[model samples]
Target: PGPFAVNTATFVGYNLGGFLGAAMATLGVVLPSFLIILIIARFVYNFLEYRTIRAGFEGVKAVVVGLIFAVVLNLLEKNIFGGTLAFKNADFVALGIMLFVLVLKLVFKKKLSAIAIIVISGILGLIFYGMFPL
Candidate 1:
């Protein structure tokens, strides 16, 4: 519980095969994308010059942005608001941490790194919920 971590391919590989496994897993994860990019690099410049392709890429970008916004809203409703359908409860601490980090980022113009925000939020949670027992 000292540091929060994501269980990525390297983590899984290390869990299964130690250092070598982690290296292999990292290579396996990256190699395909590397080779594909290498193969596509020749055509990508010319492809982007086409008006239809450019338009398609713009459409894709818009859809991706919309999907990201939708996901964030859904998570906020379910986790922070405690069920959008029922509206039965709300997690004030979770909401507070979210708003605090959001306001800090906005006020500072994203000068804060993600790690700093996470550590600060974790400490705030411990102080409010663990140590002081709010």
Candidate 2:
């Protein structure tokens, strides 16, 4: 109901039918996934009992983790390392903040919560970038 991804469907629906269209579009997008999950829920417990299925799921989990790691690496390369954007000017401030946060996290070994990291990052951004006259 609240995912940002749903905004695409809602936008299309609004363009087509206004509020009613948006509602319908949202329902159209959500209902199938909801129904699919519901249908799968009945068999999930029994399905998990199979060793092959469990192994397949484990493989899927590994793939998902790898994909997530790849995305993080891609973001770091593009944004922090200034891959393409370096042609214009690399945002050294952002790079510094990223390195600082990465080092802090590595040093602390995630003793910091996500909220704490976000707050610290925001403050660092303010100190480094926001406070400066542009």
Every model's Cα RMSD, please? 7.6, 5.7
Q: In candidate 1, what are the lDDT values of residues 5-36, reduced to their tens digit?
A: 22387789899999999889777877787789
For 1-134, candidate 2 gives per-residue lDDT tens digits of 45875899999999999999999999988998899999999898899999999999999989986996799788778865765553244566456657576748754896876468768777766876678622
Q: What is each predicted model's overall lDDT from 0 to 1?
A: 0.72, 0.77
Q: List the residue pairs that clash in candidate 1.
A: none
Q: Report how far off residue 113 is in candidate 1 (Å).
A: 15
RMSD of 1: 7.6
Compare the candidates by lDDT and give the number of the best one: 2
TM for every model, in the order presented, reads 0.46, 0.51
